[model samples]
Target: MPAARSGSTRSRPIRRWCRSISRTTRSSRIVSTRPARCARPRIPISTRSSPTTRAGGCSCARTPIIARAARPPAITAASAPRRTRTRRRRPRMADQNLIENDEPLLVAKSLSKSFGRINACRDVSFSLHPGEVLAIVGESGSGKSTLLQLLSGQLAPSAGHVSYRMRDGVARDLASLGEAERRFLFRTDWGFVHQDPAQGLRMAVSAGANVGERLMAVGWNHYGRIRDTASDWLTRVEIDTARIDDAPRTYSGGMRQRLQIARNLVTEPRLVFMDEPTGGLDVSVQARLLDLLRSLVAELNLAVVIVTHDLAVARLLSHRVMVMKGGRVIETGLTDQVLDDPREPYTQLLVSSILPP
Candidate 1:
């Protein structure tokens, strides 16, 4: 009976061993068939100190391996598509040939104007060459705008003569020209950009018509061509062509200013007069407008005479700057030189006033 008990004990252990092997084989088959279902549970790194943790504890502690498995594939030069290079085109400006000349485009001598006893402008004389930009800068009532008016022939100088070289190569006194001839010159050879868009743009007319009117004045009669030219000018100034038929009154301030610019520039005038072109706009709008104006001025090579109280504007756009105070030019020189090293006390004061405290 003792020997029987020993054999039974041995059989019990062998039966248990067989059962354990069978269970392990079944688990292996299940894991092979369904890996997701049998995937090892993720133990957080915080569970590492727990007594229940077996072997190495938290799998999350192996961050390098986990990160490697989760990482996206690298991009290599061989996988990238080849890019073709093309030459960049330049901005096209109208009337390039007409303005390109050896002689100065416009000459002013002792230009002066007055309103009753007030001297609105006094002895403001400067010559503008082709592709040159001159900025008249000062405080309000300082005769900068008046000087611009006298130069553009919008106001007759009380004394002094403004002379412009004609397209036919004849330099004539602006005051001596016949009224009709002067009107023709104003329409074809000169462009005026006012501080107020309302003053420059026709509020009642469609934006397209405002631009096309200048073309019509120059004898562009074809309906299709005039519309096309107007569209082109609007696009050049960054206005959407969809707004071409809308009136200036329906547009925003910046849009109206851009439209006014398009109207004035459509005829490709040799000379342009601007009075505070970026005035009354928000800072962002002013920056964009100034950038556009700079690009257009460079592309067109148009001689410009601009009046502004903003010295920064003068520095950015002008080749030469004329600083005025009390209706007289106090200092005139290259833009950077005059602004950086002022020879006159008034100019020094003007520059210092705009500097940050």
Candidate 2:
């Protein structure tokens, strides 16, 4: 009975060891059951493990496996869509006619300026179109200068009104505009080139300053940009960029005139008024200036009202001519037609006075 009891004790220990091993195996299987989303194929659970992490289980088997999508191919310039450029066509004669018929830029009806009892300009009525040059040709005492002053709003008319088309396409009387508005127009929309360069430009300031002053008035406060633009305009007016620091007082008459032009044109004014622009210059200088003016006017498509006594100047620069005798325009017509065949006796006499070239 003692031997049988000892055998039973040894058999009991062996049964307990087998039961512990079965429990460990079942726990490992439960932990290793992975979700179906894992890309890794079904892997067997490992029995070996780090002592610090776990007793007998694989770390990777306990953690969930994550799947990621493959990257797409990169796009190249060669595979990109192409862009096309549309070319601009030049306007035909019909297009020009249509544009002329659209709207007038400036219109004056029976405009007259009286200095007390003396009437400087009498009942002058005319219409100026965009991209058109109109020359008022007469003797020194004729009403052309006064008429120009009236059209530009420099002098108030006593009898009639002058109307100008604003940038917003509305025609407004100059007298109706406030002082600030009129000054604004002079700064941004209109330019006046005085007969004397000293009158047009600020002679005390540097050439760059003179040119940049207009820009400053229009709200351009950047120093570098204003200087660059002034330099470009100086070059355009045939003035040396090196002379940008020089004052207009030190410049020659022609140079000063060119600088004045640059100052006026820097703002790209819609309309420019000129009073005997080439009156004081030599023949060669006058020719050069006229050529430059013609090119610029055509390029910018500007409207100009130039008052000059020289019929040759009118012939060269104007598309249309208005012949003024005393304080009245005796005849008005196309430049060539008026100069070649004058309807009025005074116009005929004035045309005959020009020396043959």
Candidate 3:
């Protein structure tokens, strides 16, 4: 009976091993089928208001994965689209119509000047009429002052011609005139107000002498009449008649400027060339001087060509404005038109930069 029981235990062990092997085989089949199960995609169930498909009208089942990834995120009011601004058009100036009827008092035709390879003034041509004030404005080294010098005969142009009408109504080329005739014209028909009072005035001499010297140059030899005329001019420019005997060195900056103006205008010149007449003065003093200058210019019906960097001075005193850049006339027109609605980009920048008074 013991041998039979041992044999039955061995058989039982073999049956148990076969059952464990069957279980292992089933577990391996299940693990291997997981990948195939995952490979088959589930059919997407459609709803009335699906977040992804509702707006785009696309089915999630057919939608490309790349297309989904490439879609931009939603935008709100805070993320409104931006747009670029277009530039406004500039206005045309009516300069030709304004100066058509009047014969130009001074005509510069194709004026040009060159220093070595540098063109200091290039083909700058403009007309100045009688009783009209033209302001040439630009930054330092822009050739505005050089153009003034050329027009005034202080510097000869490398090319071009300047013609000025004589008292006898003949337009004479200034460059062709003799030195004596030019000197005579400068003393009688023209006046120049230098930027520095020392240059314009006889600094060592008395103010009366400074003014009377101009009269003497034009053949006013009577000492008493010259002194009387000088005294009258001193009063006219708002300088104290008593200070007429004082040297310009003893005077203030504004006074010296005033004295210089008196000296230039005392002869009643038909044309005047000013190089920053109101420069180097306090704002209040400049305003007063500008007023005085405007009054005198109008009263005398003087034609003027003024060179200045100050746009405010140009706006205040000039009938026409010429904007220079890189030795070229970039823009020019009536003063109000140029200052109020500048056409050129550079001129617009200049007009915009002016501080309001």
Candidate 4:
């Protein structure tokens, strides 16, 4: 009985010692743990247009240009793009707005000219309409040429104004333009035929050269056209085409004058100023030239202003006549009425002196 009790007590003591060691180990346990740390990937906001026309990966909606980031630098939310302002467009108007209402192609308003003591022209007012021919007639030294020069923009008027047609087909007050501005008109709009044939034609050059010289003056260099135009003009003016190459030096007075006319007319100038066109030619030749000029003017719808002492030339060529004396216009009327009725004393004298040419 004593031996059995001692063995049971020893087994119980060993079980209790193992249980105590297990409890101490459980209390001393350490738990190793870390907070969650995952990487957030950086995304770029693209503003560049796509290279392909189809815009494969483009994010741009309009023509806004995107700026590149600063070199070797990190970007932040504060460094965003700014917007640009667009310009406001204005409406346009027609050139008719630039011109005064319903003015003639040329208007010489109270135009006066004085070469020192000599009063060449005074208070000369006239208007030239498109397709109309006007003749200014007077005795020698009565300022007809001077008035023509003034209207043609060759000489600036000492007083008054001249208006010439512009690109809009409206007359512009020439007094408003500087010399440089007026040159623009001379380059394109007008032509002049001088009283002297020599002044109109270059004597050294051929008749063809004389005719085609205007084309050259206006910057035309095409040889075939120049040749054809010159030849055609020669034929039109009744000059023989075989004589087209001959110089004015070789030509008679009438031929020289005809050449001069052909030279001025070939350009088909809108407004032409002629000084005594049929001055020296015989009656038959004068009639021929006048007929030719009339046909050409009608065909081309040309406007002309002629300064002449020849009443016959005025009657033949012009629709209207302005009689000037002592630097003033004495009478102005339709050509037939002025010639036949003779309102002014000077007109009567001129009509009486004509001798029924």
Q: What's the CA RMSD of model 2 in angstroms?
A: 14.0
Off by over 4 Å in 4: 1-102, 175-184
Rank order by TM-score, top first?
A: 2, 1, 3, 4
Instruction: Return the TM-score for each candidate structure.
Output: 0.71, 0.73, 0.71, 0.67
Listed per candidate, the RMSD to the true structure in angstroms reads: 20.5, 14.0, 26.8, 21.4
Which residue window of length 10 is worst by lDDT in model 1?
15-24
Looking at candidate 4, the ten consecutive residues that score lowest on lDDT are 15-24
Which stretches of model 3 miss by more than 4 angstroms? 1-101
Q: How many backbone collisions does model 2 have?
A: 0
Ranking by lDDT: 2, 3, 1, 4
True-structure lDDT of candidate 3: 0.79
lDDT at 147 for candidate 3? 95
- Cα lDDT listed for each candidate: 0.79, 0.81, 0.79, 0.72
Clashing pairs in 3: none
lDDT (10s digit) by residue, model 3, range 91-136: 3434543443267779999999999999999999988888899999
lDDT of 4 by residue, 1-357 (tens): 011132221111111111111011112231221221211212232223222112221122111212211122333346546657898755333334233324578888888899899899999888877778999999998889889888887888999998887757665787778887766455456777776789877899888888777788778899999999899888888889999888999987778877887787776677888988888778887887788878887887678999999888889889999999989999999999999999888899999997752
Clashing pairs in 1: none
Candidate 2, position 162, lDDT: 92
